[model samples]
Target: MTPVNPESSTLYVQSLATGVQVLRAFNTQRASMSLPEIASAVGISKSAAQRFAFTLEALGMLKKDSQSKRYSLSSANLESGYQYLQCHPLLERANPYLLDLNQRTGETVNLAEPADDCMVYIGRFSSLARLIAHVPIGQRIPMFCASTGRAYLSSLSDDAAREILERSDRVRYTPQTVTDVDALLTLVQQAREEGFACCHDQFYRGDLALAVPIWDAAGNAVAGLNLSVSSTSFTVKRAINKFVPLMLETARLISTTPPNPTALRPFRTEPRGPKEAG
Candidate 1:
């Protein structure tokens, strides 16, 4: 009798997984990829990459350039994310409050949920004053340095937060990023004590962000709400003093809304392994 390979279980569709991996290989760093590049990025053979690329192109999920022979994500790739945001219960409840904060402060307001060691931006309202070039919905920022990340971390038990911090890559994104685990733990502890987190030019230079965690009805932290203002506009002390109370109020108001049991339960305080690409 032949032994069954557990990794090739009948319930798991390896081909579908590989096809998704091929699409994920194209990201902000590599917006367009050749067949060889796709194969190398996805750890698949060139022929398999070609087959998956062809299938994805046929499905309207990828577009192939005739001249360059490189594949890029199509408009169809956005449909899933759009559908998710449109239907997400948390975003539905939080939007009004987030918009209010944005209008009041005239700063960029964002809502992020934890994905392993990174915070994924799910909601954003641009500041009328000036828009930051990089932040878009679906962007991921490191949990070790971002204000939203720290706000979420502050909701977790110290041990769990430490585990996450220790597992993070801990590279300095900017000179201001606190990469030491002990120092980061101190910051999380301070955030826990203060009921909010603040970052000054940590993730991006001249970007100052302040954040507070959003909790579910069950007292689990499900997400974070943050407001970002440029250093050119306000000093850190002034920004904190001006925005912290208002942000706390906004986050508190949003937290009161009962979250979808199934949609939100996964984001509670437990540490996660590295997130998988969709």
Candidate 2:
């Protein structure tokens, strides 16, 4: 039966849908909502909402504020959303460009989005390897250490980047990983100036990933496009001379699109070959 009040339907009963919906209800503004507030926001009974929140927290979907006993969403939701957009039309507008890029660069072309504290590889065009770097589509890389992460981070506001960095673990992934906050801040500044970011073996062992940011109509870096090669195939110099320009071209094409994101198609994966690390 329809609710007597339309507002009530949006504000109340629909809140009772599932654990997922309840988890989604938490956002930046509602960061630390109390159990009762969550119940009202999702239109669920206090007991049931608390149960769902507890379950979500157990699963790392929600975090309970130790001080206030409120709840907020964990980074897992961001990962799920990134994976969804990766395969959808969100990357469609960029597929042809990526394919051309892969052919021209003769390397794996990857599209990524800011997922949790890292830029997760979403779309991939593989050649010479079944998939480059053995990085699954859901794999997470450190924002400060990966070229894709830096490219997007450079496009974000200073405060936003620092906030995320401060909230993250900032663990040392490799000897090359820039775990120093001050140094990363400086690198971010350089990336903003140069219009792209490059990292060699920072995100993964002996992996070279170069990336540029794709902006939305709002001028926000909504996505990142990258070319990844193993330490055996291309040198940092070769990536810059041969691949950077085309990668930037793809980024520009995608950034110039209307508000909606474009989708990019995936090619083939091949065996890892010999190349120099960038």
Candidate 3:
């Protein structure tokens, strides 16, 4: 991740920031948005939004519908993410293991990285089960509530983890979501000691997940690997006992894989979107 000095603002480009914000306004929920809606969502004037939209459309990153006069992301927009995954050595090495784990458990598996106060899903393998949650890649979940986030936090120093949790929005997503700072700190400490983290219905009701942090050659927690199952299919205890070993093994395998000769840059922090269950 590129380090930023918050005190320095001269290097920041406001136009570029606004352009990126305009692009992020398009999502599964808001697949297409009119210029007015975009302006409101991005907190910009309609003329500025129109300029951003026009520039994006001209660049082939967005397309405007003639009938509704709304703009939507185009296939070209996916190129950036495609290039990211293609160059990420960790995801490249972990793909086969994630596939194997998915087949063995018949459950969803996720590869995620901590970004700011959330964990973003960068890679995922879907379960064959008929009743699984639809968690698309690029979905973000709060660090305090997600198993993957907790696992990554566990690998950090207590003070670092506490700082992140303090900055988190902490909006209660479910009854199980832990908002208390002290309680969450305890969970992080426990995960650090146990080498894994488990969350039951915290991010979403009826969803259960287990995760372990993936370390890099330098011993930094580069990513987190998660196994997600439905509460109806297995108890939390049962899921942890059955999958924790596999998760740890997969994390170790990813950690030991050498970095790509042409290293990939880490993902940028974008505008926050709706949270999804991991």
Leading candidate by lDDT: 1
- Order of all candidates by TM-score, from best down to worst? 1, 3, 2
Q: For residues 84-143, could you state the per-residue lDDT of candidate 1 as single tens digits?
A: 999999999999999999998888999999999999999999998886556889999999
Which residue pairs clash within candidate 1? none
Q: How accurate is candidate 3 locally (lDDT)?
A: 0.81
- lDDT digits (tens) for residues 148-198 of candidate 3: 999889888999999999989988887767788888888887678677777
Off by over 4 Å in 2: 1-87, 129-132, 257-278
C-alpha positional error of residue 62 in candidate 1 after TM-score superposition, expressed in Å = 1.1
For candidate 2, report its TM-score: 0.63
What C-alpha lDDT, on a 0 to 100 scale, does residue 160 get in candidate 1? 100
Off by over 4 Å in 3: 1-11, 257-278
Q: Model 2: per-residue lDDT, tens digit, 1-278?
A: 75767655556654345786787677667777898998898888999888989888998988888998988888887877676766676478878888888887678888888877888777778866534467666667778777888888887777887777777788877766667677777767656766767777776776777787887867678778888887666666666667666776677777765322222212112222222121
Cα lDDT, model 3, residue 8: 58
